[model samples]
Target chain A: MRIAFAGNPNSGKTTMYNALTGRSEKVGNWGGVTVGSKEYPIKEEYTGGKEVVAVDLPGAYSMSPFTPEEGITSEYVRTANPDAIVNIVDATNLSRSLFFTTQLLELGIPVVVALNKSDINEKEGTKIDVKKLSEKLKCPVFETTSTEGKGLKDVISNAIELVGGGQSAPYVQADINLQNKAEVDAEDRKRFSFVNDIVANVEKREMLSSETTKSDKLDGVLTNPIAGILVFAAVMWAVFWVSQAWLGPLVADWLVGWIETFQEWVAGKLENSPAILSALLADGIVGGVGAVVGFLPLVMVMYFLIALLEDCGYMARVSAVMDPIFKRVGLSGKSVIPVVIGTGCGIPAIMACRTIRDERERRATSMLATFIPCGAKIPVIALFAGAFFAGAGWVSTLSYFFGLLLIFLGALLIKYITGYKYRKSFFIMELPKWKMPSLKFAFKSMMERAKAYIIKAATIILICNTVVQIMQTFDWHFNVVEEGAENTSILASIASPFAILLIPLGFGVWQLAAAAITGFIAKENVVGTLAVVYGLTAFIDVDELEMTGGANNVAMATGLTSVTALAYLFFNLYTPPCFAAIGAMNSEMKSRAWLWGAIGLQLGTGYTVAFLIHQFGTLFTEGHFGNAFIPGLIAVAIMATAVILIGRKTRAHFDEKYRLHRDGKSGAAA
Target chain B: MLLNAEPGKTYTVKEINTDDEEMNSFLFRLGCYVGEPITLISKKKKSCIVAIKDGRYNLDELLSSAIIV
Candidate 1:
């Protein structure tokens, strides 16, 4: 039996799926989550006949295909031809949920209504006439409390009974579905008249109750100019708390333990064969991408929490709440998606740019996405915190803040430069209901994101590592230095030019410098590169912390003070993202010149900012600022001024001077 | 005249009279899009902030010109 569960965000679709299928779960990358369908099988014990494959598709409110989730869900329902579909609906939000039920019925299938969240509905004084709704739709409906394990047997049994029964649900097909869709196919125009009619009949509660209007009461203040700003700040604080305090360190600790075990096992296996062993364990795989992959647990945890909030619809709530500030910056609230997700990984975050269609806004989005320090680069920040900054959580927090600050400033710069003067852009978005996100949904989502990360590590990261290993095996200085020398190795030969570039960022020493250059290919390679050059993988164990180069190995690697380390983290955070982001630019722009232009823009912005920091940041330490710092601050001020002005220009549509230039073309026609 | 269509001025939609023939038909075809009223959040050089229903939208001059209100 092929059954599909479909519904909107927070509608208990996944909770119901997990309840039905338990631990026998198999998940793959469903095109970067947000709108991917996950399928699992349930073996029938007594029947001993057929296996039912049930697919749980991403949730959406309507079948309009506005969001990617809507597109994937509606397409599967229409074409997949499942035996039965359980359209899970939030019982408390029946009026809105029925909007999809009406659309699902239009697909000519028997959709059994799984009225989830019934537990919360009764508390909220909501009543659903499921029997009446079924009669109205010409199908069976069951009230299910997936969280509390209520009504699953009845829902499943009804699903099994309805399968292959060839029944149609009670749905009003447009009496005149654009008879030609070309001429006077116009009545297809009455989009929500059906929703209005169905709700008029089904809604037991006519008007929203006072207590039910809490969102509005809250929004009045929350979305207010001042209060809304404060609320946004508080919410950001919560996000940071959730990311760093609640999840980051704990996951890192657990992952590091596992990595240590793996490293030891690999070391034992490769003891005699240095070339073969180092290539396979250190340079080829682990040195290349293993270090980054070790942090998968933390990355997955972060993505898991994000998915939970996204599934339950709180992220959208944030969008609605922050609409005002976004407007001032010439972005709608939804533009913040890239910013929020960008903090995780620029690659997926850049791919998430698929959600934004406007060319100018998308460019603006990409520019800011690079500014958000991703998980791959977070190690640099943490390394600084642990080694130099007394492992102060606050210093780690400041690096993130620095990244976000740059993003804001960068967005303003984009607004100033483009004014999106030529192209058109618009934002029309939907806000889903808020509910408790399911652990099943969160787990599935985390696994999917990790799958993508894994694929990346295996392919691009592994290949980059192999190339670094192969080249470093050769002597670039005409073999003047011996093969096993400390500082004159082949890796150092390739890293010389870029080493000069990092001098401005401070701590531009050859090894730290080389790590930065290799990081452009993939940020995760830095640690592996460090391990290879410094011989940290086998020579020194973390437990021993033995002497190396007249100092502890950890101390030797981390000799830079906190301020310098923080500066390194800041510079890396703001620098051009990995080459994958460069590839993204090429694909997005579809112009070679434009790609190079974007690269130039990223490099210029990164170097300029870091240079400003390097030239004058000495003031913080020595209490005396440099003359070189003055120009950099001037550049920052000038950029800020341009953004403020251009922000105004973007907010107001087509001023007289620009309009005159636009109409000037038409003037020639006149 | 389209209400609040001043060259530089922007305004929030307070009351959209469903009786406006052109605007009503246009929005309806965009799919029950009437409940979501738009606020002319700002008017800069060549862009505008439109608060549509619950979401705030940024529309450029070309797209904004197509929006009747």
Candidate 2:
């Protein structure tokens, strides 16, 4: 049997898919789009055992084929003709969820409605006549809680039975062309009204109960300008506390133990220059790759916490709190989801921007999501914190703020400086009334995400690491360290030109600079580069040199207070994203022009910000020294002036919605 | 106006399938679809936020272009 799962964003469809499929699914894209799909096998023994293939198409509101995701789903439903489609709908928000259902019905596929988040509706004092909705849609409806595993078997079993029954398939016109689509849709409010009336007849509710009321009360205060900001601050503080206090020490200790046992075991077995020891132990495995592996704990812990908040629905609140702030900066709150998700991974973050319907806003959001310090870069921040600065959280925080600054700068530049622009897009979304989160779901999501990160590292990053090691280990003519370090190491030569770029950042010395260079490939590789660069015993134990009293060690050492450490962090956070993100942008924007446009903006932004920082900090600190900082300072000023002037010229044109009156523009009314 | 109609008063969107073309570009796109009752959820600082089915959408002063509460 072939079954496709479809739903709106956050309708608990993914949660349900994961719950039912367990670890049997693979997450990937369809053909070209960056949107991820989950596919798994479903087998049942009835009379005789046979297997079913279930594909979880990307979550989308309508099969309009407006976006790549919707297009892929529409194609699947129409052509592949899945044996059945389980349309997962959020019970609490039936109106919005039903919009998709209405369209799905027209597709004429054998539909089964998984009425998810039923408790959310019940708590809100609402009751849905599932029988009626099922009758109206002409399908079986199962009121379910995907997270709780309630009604899962019934939902899928009925789906399988229906397929087995050989029910005559409903015929839906594959493509209902909307010629003069905009005008026709505009004229068809009654069509939408027809569905609305159907919902009114099928659903009834009183006022929300205490649990629902409490969540609203919390949202009321949590969304209040002053209170919400405070709440946001508290939330960030919690994340920091967990990251610094919990993850830092726990990971360091564990890695130390793992490295010690392995290091000694290797030392005992290998001779001075055993080929295996020289290549896999030292170069291929330990040198660069081990550094990346060491930071896996940090990445996993941070992602786990982020994923938990997202599933529990608190992440939406965080984005809401920032709406007012974002709007003022010419960004919508929806764009913030991608930026927030960006802290976990850029690829998904870029994909997440699919919800932004406006082309300009989506593009802008895509441009900036990479600016957020995705988890891969965490080890870089921590490395700088440990090596140069005395493990100060301030460096980490400054880097984060720099990430924000670059996003803000990119938005401003796009809004004013060029033809690239966005008409103000509204921030609209369902705020699922909060419920007590399930720890089981959170842990499962965490493990799944951490596993994806590890697998990608093993496949993609390992290949790159081997190539880099081979090149660096070779002395041009022959392999110096081992046969593994052949004359083709791509990294060492790549790291050469960047030394010129890093000169002003203090520790631009090639080895240190090489670590930063590797950062652009995958943030995880920076830690690996450092381990190999200095021949450090373990990735986390760089502080072993701190005990030495020599001026050179201390001078060369970087701990929290060093401005250079902060400066390096700034560059990494603000710089252009790696090739994977660039590839994602290429696909999403669907144009080489837009792809290059985004990359150019990132480079321009990074160079400008880093240049300003180094020049100004030097001017302030070590006395406005010689020719060191002046030219860079002037170049920075000119670039800044150009961006500002361009932005001002376009500001007036963009503000058709708001006219500037002496003080401020007359913005949209309350 | 249903005595329930006041500028800031919250109303559950009861069957709002209106033939309002001018509104579609702004009001409708912001999750203000029919039966997804929106409350004048809040009037913070400068504008109001609306609650619509599992979500809350913020609309500023220019909502005058589409909504007439």
Candidate 3:
């Protein structure tokens, strides 16, 4: 039997599904976190070993879908013949949530309404007469706290028992012309009145929502236009500083020591083996994977902090705070969610844009959100920052700030190029009550993300490192390249041409080019490939580097000055994300033109940003632009011209659209 | 009047003036419609926090202005 979990947004449907199914799907305080339907078998404990599948659908307000994700829910419930429905309603907001509940009850599916967030209601001195509510709605109602795993078993068991028993709606709309807007509106008003009547009878509240509360006071400080932006900046900077500089490196040193010891043990075991075999197993695979995994502490810590932020309901406030500023650039404040989520991973971030009502804004957000460097790129940032800048905290902090700057600039550029005219776009976001962020949930989220990071390091990064190891070991004639003749190796020969194109960016060597190329497969591959090619693995521990003639030796091997290194880091950060994230962008944008334009914009931004940094840095330090300045200038000029041409065409199209309006008005004026 | 209403004051919504049909319908679902009591919880330079039914929502200037009290 398949049971559908439906509810209003943020009413804990996904949270309940995760608890029942033992799956860690994303759960945030904000609405529209789950954009698609997900299903898994219920845990044995919950079902008592019954063969039941729980379908977790996105939250919907009513049968008539308003947003894109809400449509997913309404469509599934209406068409998909589920045996039972579990409507998870926010208990505190009973008056508003049951507006959708009545609609769900009318669907004729056996609905067992799970009044979720009952703990909140209990704290606020709100009481609901569950028996009366159930009697009135003609369904079984059980109080539940999905976050605490309370009342879940009863809800599921009740739902399972009613699998074949059909539902009977208490209040049904009279037959009317569904196509007539006025008729539908009138019917909806009646349905709401019915829900209101039921709520007034069953729900007793001690505190009215209209009264000012402590959270409201916090909002006054955190959501103030000036103070909020500064607080946001400070919070982000602290997240990076703690993760990258203070706590992360302290933990990473210990982890790297263990990794080095393990690598040494493996090398000792392979001492009697053939040179190629030993190098392949010990130095190539373990060394490369270890290099990538050494940054796990940083990634995990950042994930934990972000999860706490997401759990505490700050994201919705952040969106509300940013909406006014974002509106100026043809995007909504809701776009900020995707960009912040993009910091962890771009795939879900792009998908998160589904909540935005405007199609153009949604697509534009999906295309640009990846500018915020994700977890995969952290290793690269750490590696470069440590090697070139002595692990300065400002390096990582500056990268994130630069990313935000680019997002703003990119939005403005897109606004002009798309010929967007300022129209009145209304912004409304629910203010979910703030609570103490759950530490256990943040720990679980961090562990889930860390596990994924390690698996990728073992699988894709491991495979890429091995391939690079073999390719660099052999020549075109299928013979191992002679020592001191590494330039003739297969990998070197292929990467040489790409190196020439990067000459103007100051780092033109085939090794840097090779790392950049492999970066496309997975951003972590940049660090892995660099470790393999350089035969160095202690990128995190300063003590190890000191014994090996210090960080300057690693920097010297890469043959890049601090200026060029910063340029290269920015290049990798701003360019299009890994192909997997690009596929996500493709799916979210749902337009070939937008996808191609996104890629073009990313590439241009990466190159132009890097070129300016390297050239200007060299000019400031060495009194001249770096080599290949003229060619880089021509390339940037060509990109600039293309942008201008596209903008002009868009403007022409805009004028043409308005010209028709003027033509119609010409008659009135005459 | 929602645009200029003092904080902590309740006013009944008389109309939603936007020509956008979708916006009107969405507001209706949130229980922000004619005759519903709406409270102006707080006001900002560009947006206002409003309490409708049992939920608190932050609405921008344009949206709050459209909701005539």
Candidate 4:
């Protein structure tokens, strides 16, 4: 039997679903976190012995959908033939929630109203007489706090028992023309009045929702245009600092020690094996994968912090704070959520774009969101910071600061290129009441992400590392290349051409080029392949680097100056994310032209930024331009020319369209 | 008018004047239609936080101006 969970956005549907199904699907304090439907078998504890599957649908305000995700929810409950529907209602907002509840009750499917977030209502001195509400709605109603796992079993069991029992809606709309707006509006108003009448009968409140509350006072400060932006910057900086420079490295030092011991044990075991076999096993697999995995603590900590931030209802306020600035660039406050999520990972970040109402803004957000360095790029950032910059906090700080700057510039460029003119863009976001962020949820989220990180390290990064190691070891003739003759190896031969184009960016060696190319497969591969090619496994141990003076050794092994190393770091950080992220961009963009344009913009931006950094840093430090400056300038010039040409063509097209529209209007008047 | 409404005071929504039909109906579903009470909790330079029914929403100036209170 299938029991579908449906409700208004942020009404704890996913939380209840996660509790019943024991599945850690994304649950955030904001709405539209679940853009797609998910089905998982109910846990044995919830089901007793009956086999039940819970279909967790995206939240919808009504059966008549507003957003795409809302459409998914309404369509699923209508057509999917679910045996029962569990309409999770926010008890705090009974008047608004019951509008959808009534619609759900009319579907003939049995609906057990889960009065979720009743705990919030209780704290606010609000009371909903459950028996009275159930009697009025003619359905079973249970008070549930999905966060604490309260009353879930009762809700689930009641839903299961009513699997095949048909529902009878308490208030039904009068027969009216479905196509007429007036009829629909009049009927909807009547239905709302019915819901309001029930609310008036069943709910008693000591505090009105509209009265000024503590949360509103807090919002006054946090959503201030000037103070809010600074607070946002400081909060983001604190997250990065704690995860990268302070707490993260402190934990990583211990983890890297264990990883190094394991690497040594593997090497000890392979002592009797052939040199080729030993290198492939000990250095290629264990060393390379371990180097990537060593940064797991950093990424996990970041995920935990981000999850907490998402849980605390601050993101909605941040969006409201950023809407004006984002609007100036042709995006809206809704675009802020995706970029914030992008800091955790790009795929879900891009997926979050579905909540955005504007198509152009959504696509632009998906394309530009990845400019914020994600969890995968943490290893790359840490490696460069440790090796060249002595693990400076400014390195990571500058990376994210530049990332945001690039996103702003990129959005503006896209706005101009796409010829998006000023339109009346409406910004409205529900400010979910703030509560203490759950550490349990944060820990669960951290573990989920950690598991993904390890699996990715074991599979994609391992394969790429092994391939890189083998290619660097053997020449075109399939013979092992001797020391100092590594240029003859297959990897060198393949990466050399790309290296020529990267000469002006400094660090134009085939090894660095190969790492950058493999980064396209997965961003972590940059660290893994770097470890494989350089035969270094100690990228995460900054304390060891300092104590043993090994930081200089690692930097020397890569044969890059500090200036060039910073350039290379920027190159990897700003370029297109992994292929999976590109696939997400493609799906969100849904336009081949836009997809190609996004990739071109990212590539040009990365190259141009790196080239300028290298050239200017060289001039400042050594009093000369970086290598191949003329060629790099030509390349940047070509890209700039292409962008300008596209912008001009787009402007001309808009003008022509505008002229034609005006002419047609005048002609009609004539 | 919603834009000039005093904070901490409740007023009934007179109308929503946006041309966008979907946004209009969406707001209607949230109990922000004509004669529904909306309370302005706070107002900022660019946006204002309002309470419609039991939910608080931050609306930009443009959207706030469109809601005739």
Candidates sorted on DockQ, descending: 4, 3, 2, 1
The candidates, ranked best first by lDDT, are 4, 3, 2, 1
Count the clashes in each prediction: 12, 22, 0, 0
TM-score of chain B of 3: 0.95
lDDT of 2 by residue, A493-579 (tens): 566577655665544556557766777788777666655555553435533413222213322543223565566667776777878
Better by TM-score, candidate 3 or 2: 3
The C-alpha lDDT values of all candidates are: 0.59, 0.63, 0.90, 0.91
Highest-scoring model, DockQ = 4
DockQ of 3: 0.84
lDDT of 4 at A333: 94
lDDT of 4 by residue, A1-670 (tens): 9999999999998999999888899999988889999999999888898999999989889988877778899899889999999999999999999999999999999999999998998888999999999999999999999998999999988998888889999988788999999999999999999999999999999998978988789998989999999999999999999999889888998999899989999999999999999999999999999999999999999999999999999999899999999998889899999999998999999999988888889889999999999999999999889888888889999999899889999999998887765567899999998989999999999999999999999899899999999999999999999999999999999999999889989978999999999999999999999889989887866465342454666788898999999999999999899999999999878999889999999999999999999999999999999899999999999999999999888777776776687774322110
lDDT (10s digit) by residue, model 3, range A1-670: 9999999899999999999999999999988889999999999898888989999998887878888999999999999999999999999899889988888878888999999999999999999999999999999999999999999999999999988888999889889999999999899999989989999999999999889887888887777899988899888898999888888878887898889899999999999999998888888999999989999999999999999999999998899889998988889989999989988998999999999998889988998899999999999998988889888888999999899889888888888787766466889999888878999999999999999999999999999999999999999999988899999999999999999989999889898899999999999999999988988886886454222343566698898899999999999999999999999999888999889989999999999999999999999999999989999999999999998898888677776766687773322110
TM-score of each: 0.71, 0.82, 0.97, 0.97
Off by over 4 Å in 4: A542-548, A654-670
Best by lDDT: 4
Model 1, which residues run further than 4 Å from truth?
A: A1-33, A36-85, A146-203, A206-221, A238-313, A351-359, A421-488, A507-510, A536-555, A558-564, A578-600, A619-670, B1-69
The positional error of residue A267 in candidate 4, measured at the CA in angstroms, is 1.2
The worst-scoring run of ten residues by lDDT in candidate 2 chain A lies at A24-33
